[model samples]
Target chain A: MDAIRIDNLTKYYGTARKGIRGIEQVSLTVAQGEFCGFIGPNGAGKSTTIRTLLGLIRPTEGSAQVLGLDIGKDREEILARTGYLPSEAMFYPGMRVRDVLKLSADLRKKDCRREAATLCERLQLDVSRKVEELSFGNRKKAAIICALQHEPELLILDEPTSGLDPLMQRAFFEILRERNKAGVTIFLSSHVLSEVQRNCTRAAVIREGRIVACDSVEALSRTSAKRVVIHGRVDLGLLSGVRDLEETQESCSFLYSGGMKELLAVLAEGEVHDLSVSEPDLEEIFLHFYSRKQ
Target chain B: MTLIKHELRQGRISLVVWTGAIAVLLVICLLVFPEMKGEMKAISHLFGAMGSFAAAFGMDRLNFGTLTGFYAIECGNVIGLGGAFFASLIGISALAKEERDGTAEFLLTHPVSRAHVVTEKLAAVMLQVIVMNLIVLVVSLLSICAIGETVPWKELLLMHSACFLLQIELAAVCFGMSAFLRRGGFGIALGLTTVLYFLNLIANMSEKVKFFKYITPFGYCEGVDVIMNGGLDIRSIATGMLFAVLGIVAAYKMYCGKDIR
Candidate 1:
């Protein structure tokens, strides 16, 4: 069964912007225990989509179901099993990090002291300090710890790793992979394609309040382009019939969707001046695809 | 209950600060009022001005000329201001604070209904007011004994008891306005307190707008008629209370489905 099902979900603010909204008709579903990344540019309705899933905002149309329960009608029951990290970090200023964690745990009727302590240690956060006194990054760490402490079944994180350093980011990714391996579904949103490419088995690229593309990283890259950067000279005109041909003034790139037979045939006729063909990253393929329509 | 405890934890210092100031002022007034016993006319003028100030602050029902008069005036002014300010702070910020602090998403993400959240927070505001009022009463009793004044205890008790409902009702008004106001919780709560007060003032000054009192918590909370008559006016209290219930219900109704940013 799908852990989360969003069908024709739409949300709008005010009557004026009937034409445009933060999220509109955005629909997608993730199977149980699937690791999915929601890739989008800023203000492309990524956060809005996540908020609707959490039932934090009402959808103007459509609906979402988590664990076979309607999110709008059964918010508390759905939320009971969900752990969410919002785009922004927010907590009561006067509270200690430990207190905040305790409050969150208490609300969900969960005892997360041990898990919270471990998460704080892993995230390099000191829960003893008051939230208001902490630095911006530290505060974000606190929020992350709170979200993960409960060991929830579903994790919906929006821009979850923005404030982390390189070392902590890797640790966080490892934790996510470990959690996913243990049957926890993860819905993460981030601009960093490299992280998504490494961590996510499947991803959906959102643009203009819609899911423009959804597929595995390998399939998306395969469908778009593969690169063969020849440092020296190469014939551009003869590259036709190669199926996926994209050559800039200084370089030539192609998609491997055809197969190695075509590439081998092309290499045979090539002058072979320091030729190297490598798989393209999701970023390169995505950009290559999007830049065309523009 | 836990939510109310949390609010009290946040608002305890403010209540104490206001309550402390009131206690000190009460002690001083008790000391001074007795010294001017022989000079009735001058004392009456001074007390009258004090009475008007109480009215401005929301203690309109009590005259300030006699011991019972001073008691009514002090209770009216001190508790009235405290209640209005308290309600404004708690009512508006109850929901707004979650948004302001960026915790609305986090809190709402839990297995708690918006209705429950609003109800819990309002309960906390009322609890805080009741606790603060109780403290003021205790301190007033001590000061009354210390000042050694022989006064009508029944009238004094009646005048001050009216404040209990007044505080709760005003707080509820601000609570309702918190939802209605587009700006934020605190802005709406404070705005309602100030707006209703002037409305009450205008109504009291003339016969034309006396009916306006029915619409505002200020009219009943600070009305002199309840105090001067030596009994509580169930009509005004009931009206103020009706608005209070309406405010809570309205806040929940709007907030349950409202989108959080």
Candidate 2:
């Protein structure tokens, strides 16, 4: 069974005449036990898609299902099995971290104290501190514990690592990997391309409210253009499939996705000193996707 | 149950402060009633001479010389206005604060349904109202006894019951308003409470706008009206409760459909 299935889901912010499109004709599915990364720049509908699936906002068009339950009809049922970590970590100001965790467990009607304690210990979160008193990163840790404690079948996280330190981010992803290995399906939404590229097996790239590409991480990287740098000044604009060209007095660099002979011919026209070609990072690929009309 | 517990815990401080402040003020007034008893008749005439001011607060209808009259006019306003403020504060903040604090994103994503959230929060607000009224009632009863005054059981209970109903009406209305508010509704709630109060006063002061009595809960719970008529106003009570019901129904409908951004 699929953990999430969205079908042409759309959301608009206001009335028809003066509405802002949140997401349009977005369709995707994540099979159970798969770790899927949803990559998008800010306001590219990454959070919108996640929030819609969680039934926090009504879709303007189409429908979705989580764990085979209809998003509108079985929201509470879906929520029972799905854990969501919102981009922002906020709780009742006076509540202790432990209290927040306990409340989440209590709402789910599950005994999560053992898992909660374990997660807190692993995250090095001080549960005794008031939510208001905790540092931003510590607050994120508390949110992480709350999301994971119930052993949910599906975990949906949006920008979950924004406030975490490098060490905690590693620990958090390690915990997620363990969860995925234990048969939990995870959907992580983030703009941090390197993080997604490292941890996710498959990724979907969203730009301007639509999924532009969905493929295995390696396949996505392979489809991206190669970065070529020439030591001598060169005008590479005439070369097909060259994008994001930057020229300095000493050298010029551009993303190349053309015949190697064509790139070599263009480089030969200039008085060459040195040249190097390397694989483009996911950041460049995403930038390429965003710059396109589709 | 979990949500209810959370709501009550969050509101406990406000509950204590409001209940404590109103109850202390009532106790202090009741304690002074005995010392002022000898001068009551003279003061009553002085208040009667104040014309419209006396009528606005129902001092025109009850003899201040009597303990029931004194308690009705003095302690009644204390509970009426103070309880209204307390209830309105809770009701206004009950749902809106979740969004204001940016916790709605954290909360609404859980297994609990919106209906569960609304009902549980309403239950918490109702519990606070009942608890505050009960505490003040106990204190008022004890003070009356300590003063060696006749308890005026029927009058006391009627006034207290009326005040409780008034609070419920205010709470329900403000709770409905809370559904639409994302941030602070303090000014609105404050203005609403004060406006309703002055409406009652206006209704009392003028025969021309007597219909204002139907629009405000204070109209139904007037201490002098209870003292003189020996019962709560049935028409006013019906009207007040209808508003309460409308407010509660509106709250549920709006909140369930609202987008939690």
Candidate 3:
């Protein structure tokens, strides 16, 4: 069974007739144990979609199921089996880090003390400090511990590494990779395109509240335009089917979607010292998608 | 249960401050009652002649010469107003604070359902109200004893029971109001509490608006009514209770369907 199945899900901020659209006709499914990345810019409906699936906000139309349980009706059951890490980490004031972790575990009705201790140690979190006393990164570590300690079947993380330093982010992803290896299905919504590109097997790009593209990482890279850079005097103006062309004295680069043979035929006519053609990174690809939509 | 405990812990410091402040004020009033006992009759007549001012506070009906009478008017308003504010503040902040502090997303995504969250939070508010009243009751009893005055057990107990009920009614109403508020309800709670209080005073002063007594919790639990009648106004108490039940039911209805943004 698919771990998450969202069909024609739409959410509006007000009444459906007179409300701002949050997400429109969003339908996607993630196979069990697949690591799917949800990439979108700010206010692009990434958080809205995640919040709707988690039952924080009701959808204006359509339906969804998590772990085969209805998002609207079986919310408690779905939440029990899923762990969500929200973008912002806010805890009750005057509570110690360990207390917040304990409260989360208790709500789940599980004995997660051992797992919590291990996660805290691995993340280098100090459980003795009060929540209000901790820095932003430390609070995020506490939030990560809370989300991971239950050993859930599915993990949905929204911008999971915003405030963490690079080292801690590495540790956080290491933990996630281990969990994914242990048969956990992960849905990660992130702004850090490279992290998603490096970690996720499949990716879904959202633009203006719609899923503009969804495919395997390799397939997406293969299907989209490739970045071409030449290090010699070349007439980029002669290149057809190319956009975003940048020219310097020694180098010229542009994204090319034309056939490789035609590009080579054109390159042989120029005085070229070096030439490189590469699959564009996710960021560039996403920019392509955004610009194309606009 | 976990939610209730966490909520209680969050409100603990404010609870202590409110309860301690009211208890200290009550103790000070009760301590001076002994020295003022000799001049009570003259003072009672003096207040009786203040026309609407005396009647507004029910000072004209209850004799100020006796300990029960003195305690009723002096300490009654202190605890009445203070307790109402405390209850209103607690109830108003119960649900809204989670959203205001940006904790609702973290909370609602957990295994517990929204209905469960509302129930536990309402339970926490009720529990805090009861605890605060109990502490102040104990302090009042000990202070009366230390002053070597007769406890006037019947009137004192009835008056306190009425005030407790009054606090609960106000709490339920404010709790219902909290579901609709997003942030900074301090002014709203204070305004609601103050309006109801003045409405009771207006009802007491004017024969034309005497029916307004039925609308405010302060009217049914008036100190003079409890002291002179030796019991609560059953009809008015029933009205207040109906309001409380309506408030609680409305709270559950509105909160269960609310989008916790």
Which one wins on DockQ? 2
Query: Candidate 3 residues A1-294, lDDT tens each?
Result: 999999999988989948998999999999999999999999999999999999988999999999999999999999999999989889989899999999999999999999999999999999999999999999999999989999999999999999999999999999999999999999999989999998999999988899999999877877558899999987756666686788899998988876788889889888999989898988778877877733
Poorly placed runs, candidate 2 (over 4 Å) = A237-241, A257-265
Which residue pairs does candidate 3 place in steric collision? none
What DockQ values do the models have? Answer: 0.67, 0.88, 0.81
- Whose lDDT is higher: candidate 1's or candidate 2's? 2
Superposed on the true interface residues, model 2 gives a C-alpha RMSD in angstroms of 0.6
Ranking by DockQ: 2, 3, 1
In model 1, the runs with Cα more than 4 Å from the true position are A16-19, A228-278, B41-63, B180-185
Q: For candidate 2 chain B, which ten residues in a row score worst on lDDT?
A: B57-66
Residue-level lDDT of model 1, residues B1-261, one tens digit each, is: 556666788888887886787667767777776665557445555544665444443344444556766665555556666667775676776676676667787788888888888888888888877887787777777777887877566765665566667778777767776655544666556677777777877776656788877776666665366556657767877888897898788888877777887
Task: Check candidate 1 and list the clashing pairs.
Answer: B59-B76, B61-B224
Give the DockQ (C-alpha) for candidate 1: 0.67
**How far out, in Å, is residue B27 in model 1?**
3.0
Top-lDDT structure, candidate number: 2
Strongest candidate by TM-score: 2
State the lDDT of candidate 1 residue by residue for A76-192, as single tens digits: 988888888877788886899888898889888789999998898888888889989987778788888878999989998899888788898888888899999999999989888
Supply the TM-score for candidate 2. Answer: 0.97
TM-score of each prediction? 0.88, 0.97, 0.96
For the candidates in turn, chain A alone yields TM-scores of: 0.84, 0.95, 0.93
